[model samples]
Target: MKNIRIVITLMLTLSITISNAGTPKNDKIETPNDSLRLAELNDFWAEVSRTVSEGDFEGYKATYHEDAVVVFTTGENKGSVSIAKALRNWEQDFIDTKSGKTRNSVEFRFSQRVGDETTAHETGIFAFQSNNGTGNDNPKQFVHFNALLIKRAEAWLLVMEYQKSKATEEEWNVLE
Candidate 1:
């Protein structure tokens, strides 16, 4: 019968289609080496953040490239440029921190890991909370942080950086 033949053909086609539908071809297979590298990068990032918040000037300088640059977006130090100047500022800060005149902590909102082992583009936002530690004053600052790091002889170093404050112009004007 013509109808029976048509039904048989339809069933054969359906079975063939179902049999060919397997796992996706694009499923990612992460290797053990990739996992280890990702973990290493994460640990390095955390150590870098910790050094700054703990007022470790030497540790902070060790984390950066020899010829690096820093830009400030907002604050009394707005439009700040020069890595050496930033280092000097941190050096002074470390001294003050010992006297309890200045203390701060940094909280990163995000740190996206991009690129390969030789180079990486990282970005995030952070809030730097500063206080007198004597309970005299308290203030918080938010900045958009960007950095480009390259592996320099096996260690990753930040070669380029940009930082823009999250505070509005009006807020800076009123506070400063």
Candidate 2:
């Protein structure tokens, strides 16, 4: 009957429309790999912060790439050491200073990937405290940092970092 044909046509049209609607627009779709990269990067920094605060140098070192490069802002005071050696050097220092409520807080923003989902960059600010807790006379110092991360098999590790202390008075004045 004509009614049957009309019903079939309507059903077909509805199905087509539904399928088309569900399809993504021209906007680039973020693949699952992209999501994993973001989470891995976040977790890497999180563990770094936790390890430093807990005085677990080994745990902190585990987040870095095998051949990672690090540039420190307070190099004179903090001492410059290779990624692998730095962890060992800092381990005793961290433990010695562990009695205080010292803490390190990391805040990073997601960045764009350069080539594929396997590599990306991020930047953020860090707050470091020497006080055992928030109530101490010591204040948290702000430092700016940028990091490069590369995805390895089942892991995303920090390959490099550029770190610096807060801008100087002259630098701040120039910006103003």
Candidate 3:
């Protein structure tokens, strides 16, 4: 019985060692560079907001990867679409804002962010408000979103944008 117990303990120890060997040592270590990487991501989102607010269509377009995808859940629009198509649909708004026919702004608040040095998944809520120059009521619109980004050629570009659903002001405030 003593010999059997010794064998079992040794087996268990070996198994644990093997398992740990397969795991990356830095998996849970927070390196100083983590904050710097996150700051770069924050700047990426800030540029998105800035381009949209200023109606810089070309600049906004440059934020996306050439083959990016956009997913949405609006009525009659419940699937993934090419970023080019999405941009086409949204171009008129940018043009309107640029021509002074309207004013628009968007802001984002993050709930979670995960990524490595080359990739990122950002989950957040965005508030968009538009004024059509007319006296019509323009309420702020809030949305829950997840954006996947990749670092390419030292520039961060959005690869996939998932506009999940509508978000309330309360939900947006909680992230803050």
Q: How do all models score by TM-score?
A: 0.66, 0.60, 0.83
Candidate maximizing lDDT: 3
Q: Residue pairs in steric clash, candidate 2?
A: 100-132, 101-131, 101-132
lDDT of model 1 at position 92: 77
The alpha-carbon deviation from the true structure for residue 87 of candidate 3, after best TM-score superposition, in angstroms, is 0.8
Which lDDT tens digits does candidate 2 get at residues 37-156? Answer: 666766777787787777776667777898987788664655344677666656665674565545444333332343357787776555565655555636555566677888788777
RMSD of each: 10.1, 10.8, 4.9
Clashes of 2: 3
lDDT of 2: 0.65
Q: What TM value does model 1 have?
A: 0.66
Per-candidate clash tally? 0, 3, 0
